[model samples]
Target: MAEWGSAWSTTPSVGSRVVVTGAAGGLGRELTSVLAGLDVTVAGIDRPGTTGTSGVPLIEADLTDDAAARHAVEEAADLLGGIDALVGGAGIVDTIHRADTFPLAAFRADVEANLLAQFVVAQAAYPALKAAGTSSLVFLSSIAAQDGLPGQASYAAAKAGVLGLTRSLAAEWVSDGIRVNAVAPGLFATPKVLAMPASARDRLLASVPLKRVATLGEVVGSVLYLLSPAAGYTTGQILRLDGGAGLTLGGFYR
Candidate 1:
């Protein structure tokens, strides 16, 4: 423990080589900015036509496509001289839907975006991370995955897959000196979440122990911890950053 602390003291947050997928999205963009401020080298990948903040080497590609995702991962590894960390921030959410009425096509699309895309990126980044020898991977999950929230069946299922992915990968990759985990965050102030009707939002907020939405800084801090050596001994875990909504879950019905 002391040895890791000493190492962290010297390396700091700077000099880390990281790749962030879904880089143009709300959470991704915020994480990228924070990484930049830390002086870490970052390669960002997202769908075409989305612009990431300046200073990162942005690679635009449809990550739902396995081949394109692999290419982007390899390219990001090359650009970073190897990857010390990867943040699988790509996701899709279906709000206000009834499971019985949800179309199979829509359900499949959500799975592809929220679950399979993360798998694609994670698998593609494994070789690069293994080569790095002491790397970390963080997957994005949601509080929806934990409880049976109404109108969130498809999204919940996909995010639940992420939790399973996190645990499995953490076990499989530990021998390679790689750490894997996930953050099952509650409602954050992202565009999608903020767009919920006020009454609906209020209902959700009242259920939160924190009584407010999570800020970008809070989520980013959790990500930084998992990626840094400070959490070196942590793996196969889900950091439930949900403000205790998991403790009591009835108010957030959507």
Candidate 2:
């Protein structure tokens, strides 16, 4: 087995305070676990009623609420002594609904949950990130953003917004030594996807040229890379971890 702790110590030093939002979910929890094992102080923010994995300080707050997001950032900065990286991973995938008939309320909720929440969190962390110097901001987008997945209008729109945010912030903060970027994950076997019917799951898998869904580890590796000095020169880029699904044109004319 790989020595997780030793491996992390050999990686480039990038301060220590690493704050991850939505640390209760599968990907979020896994990322938190990995960071914690590296001996980095991690502070997580989830919904007010949600609970995160054990052994980490999880602050209860809703990212959609600007005040709550600010509070979470402040609390995390206080707990960790400073903020070195901000991982915007909290998101929601609502029930699919036809665009024409999709409730406007649901659409708004989706946008707020996915895109706006990231914005709020980033804004809240800006000062702390600047203070830390050489900090990184990682946003979680989705393949749906670039693929225009049917029945995912809201999700696509929100995730696309994240790409825009990533690029803009990368430019805006470069002089300040803060790097900003985003990760667009392809279909992964998370709890959410695994709960789908077998037929539905198989159909989705067939769309990927790789013929399989991505593992959470693959996706998280991209995030870690961006935050590490290995990607010191990389910024304003949207790294896609989608098993080649984004390149396929099979569903374009369907």
Candidate 3:
């Protein structure tokens, strides 16, 4: 993958500050790697004991806790001096279960983990982003949001909320010169998806027009572009990075 520096030769130059949540997760770690490669000031928010990316300072905090979530962002801004961009990639994928059988507690917890935490982190970073004048935020949404498949009731609801929040904030924060966007991926080859039963996983992959899971580089590159000046004029958009999984004649689902 090309270094971000090789593409954009603009402000937000060397030493630009960035904060990533769930920085220990598969996608988050990939994002951190690219940011570190670009030699920027980076900070991460992850659960305690998570060995986050090398050289990136991490704020150990439970993002599901509102106070902890806010504090994490505050501390990261302090560590980076200021935040020029944010990637809210922290979330959990609930175990597959029928909607009728899904526990109320688990459903609520999914909402907090996947939706509320993202909002709290973004709110916490608002001041630093506003101060930066020109900034960007990328929220990790999911194909489940658009796919009302069995066993995805709770997860889909939360991810859909993320997309809605992304649009709302994009319109509201544009005045502050913050470009907000979302990437809703389908069938990514992450640990969580890979952990799915082979039969289930194969079924999902076969539904994709491309018949494959999205690569980490593709998703990471999209995030980088949205957070870069290249997408300066782009905001309030949802880039469905689904490997053509959601592009079928009548329906994309199997």
Candidate 4:
């Protein structure tokens, strides 16, 4: 890992402010910890019942609510005196049913939680990101978005939307010095993946060339690269950290 100062000639200082949504969750917590290790001031937002970790300030907000999203951004900005990066790590996966048998309510809820929440956060943070000039915005997508898994229609659609959002915003904000990008992770050893049935878990692992799930730290590393000056010229792209699962299409189809 390169020192923060040497990573980007124009990158913000280590103590710069970063806001992460879904902070209490598996991936979110790992991201928060990594940012904190870099000496960045982090403000995490999750729903009620999810509290801060490691003494980092955690704000309770259902990001699906536009007003609450805006308020969280405002409060975080005020606390940090400014915002340098906005990492939208909150998303939901409805794995209970196939598309044909999936409940409409469940689908709608997944869309709201995964897709709309990201939109709300990005919209609310646009001003702060623009003000920061060289700020970065990262969205957590999934391999399901591109692979279109059997029972993940809602999650796939929502994460696919995130890819579109990242590209469009990266184009729209280049002039403002804000970079927008996304990470598409394959099966990782997160709380969600750990909860899958044994058979389903084995099948998921078999699809990957590595035959093993990723760690939260590996996923966070890719995110940090995108947000850092190392990827200063990289934006409007989706970094797939799936252990080559996307390349094993024949196995998945078999």
Candidate 5:
């Protein structure tokens, strides 16, 4: 085996073309801004009323709709000359509800936003990714999938589906030179998260082995690494950025 030296870069190639979904959201907007500053051309797809970020082309579309998602991705590809990477960040976590009483419609909505939408966007970007001869697709999952947070049945189920989808796509698209992976983030210090009541934040922090929440930069760093040449040989893997929180979960003895 080769020695662990700087054989490759952990950053996206300068001038690389990237597409981001859910660009209007906090994480998506942050990611788009970071990519734009990295010399990579970026285009974002979000809901129709989202305000466009400066320096990033934002295309409004209903990502859960197959036709609309495909059209938006194709338009982004056309504008960028082709696509080198795609970040499927569009998803929704509905208000917490008990599984027994969770509306079927709400469950479907979560599955549609978190699972089906990701698949559709990936399908739409396949041609461009294949044409690039080497590309990366990163999906956002959640630690809830593993820890099974209470009142998050639908969100957890949808995120678990994302894991399955990531692996399947990685296997099917390996020959096409497309790499697929996912990032499962735990409680991160986003605006909304940081604004939580002190007691709530403390409760969350107590569960994390690190005794703290992850920074948005750290989560973004994971995505960036997976999309760069350094992770070229890595695919179908889920990188859990939960600060060892997964270890705190109880395990079945049987």
Candidate 6:
């Protein structure tokens, strides 16, 4: 594997202050554990009433709202002293619905949950991230943004928006020493995925060259890489975690 000279550390520096949104979700939870194990001071933000992750300070606030997002980041910054990195993993995938009949309300809600929340949190963290002199912001995007996944019109659009925001922020924040990037993951072996009917699951895997869902470790590792010194020069990039699923001309999955 090609490596960058001396800057190839897969783990963030110990004592780095990091904040993760949606830290209670499956992927977020796993990412937090790995970061904490590396001795990085970690704090998390999730929706109100969500279960808190052990050992990590959890701030429950609605990130979609500007005021609430600012408050959450302030609380997290206070807990960590300051922010060196931020992972925008908080999002929602409301019930899948076709584009033709997807409710206007749901479409708006999905965009707010997935796209707006990310931007809101990032904006709130800007001052702290800038003060850190050099920092990283990694957002969770989805392969739905790349491939046509049936019944996911809103999700696909919102995730696509994330890609745009990632690049825009990277360029705009470069002078501030804050790098912005995103991870676009395909099907992953989460509980919700495992519970899918066998036929549907198999059909989904058939399109991928790897023929299997990604492990939480595999996907989380990619996120960690971006947050680490290894990707110090990488910004405005979307790291796709799909198993060559995008290499083919596969049609939308029903």
Per-residue alpha-carbon lDDT of model 6 for 62-81, expressed as tens digits? 88888999999999998889
User: Weakest 10 consecutive residues, lDDT, candidate 4?
Assistant: 4-13
- Every candidate's lDDT: 0.86, 0.85, 0.86, 0.84, 0.88, 0.90
Once fitted onto the true fold, the runs of candidate 2 whose alpha carbons sit more than 4 angstroms away are: 1-15, 250-254
Task: Show the colliding residue pairs in model 4.
Answer: none
lDDT at residue 170 of model 3 (Cα atoms): 94
Instruction: Single out the weakest 10-residue window by summed lDDT for candidate 3.
Output: 4-13
Candidate 4 to truth, TM: 0.91
- lDDT (Cα) of model 5: 0.88
lDDT of 2 at 104: 91
**After superposition, candidate 6 runs with Cα above 4 Å error:** 1-6, 251-254
Name the runs in model 1 displaced over 4 angstroms: 1-4, 7-13, 94-96, 249-254
Best by lDDT: 6
In the range 1-254, model 1's lDDT, one tens digit per residue, is 87656556422256889999988988899999988888689989999899997888899888889899899899999888999999999876755579989888888888898999999999999998899888999999987787756777889899999999999999999999989999888888898778899988887788787888999889988888888877878899999887777777363443
Span of 10 residues, lowest total lDDT, candidate 1: 4-13
Give lDDT tens digits, candidate 5, residues 1-254: 34344437777877789999988888888889888889689999998899756989999999888999999999999999999999999998755899899989888988999999999999999999999999999999987776676887899999999999999999999999999999999888778888999998887777677888888889888999998888989999999998777676551100
TM-score of each: 0.93, 0.92, 0.92, 0.91, 0.94, 0.96
Estimate, for each residue in 72-142, the C-alpha lDDT of model 4 and write its tens digit: 88999898888899999987774568778998888889989998899899988889889987989999998
lDDT of 1 at 8: 63
User: What C-alpha RMSD separates each model from the true structure?
Assistant: 2.2, 3.7, 3.3, 2.8, 2.8, 2.2
Model 6 per-residue lDDT at 130: 99
- Alpha carbon lDDT of residue 51, candidate 6? 76
Error of 2 at 59 (Å): 0.4
Per-residue error (Å), model 6, residue 151? 0.8
* Model 2 lDDT at residue 2: 48
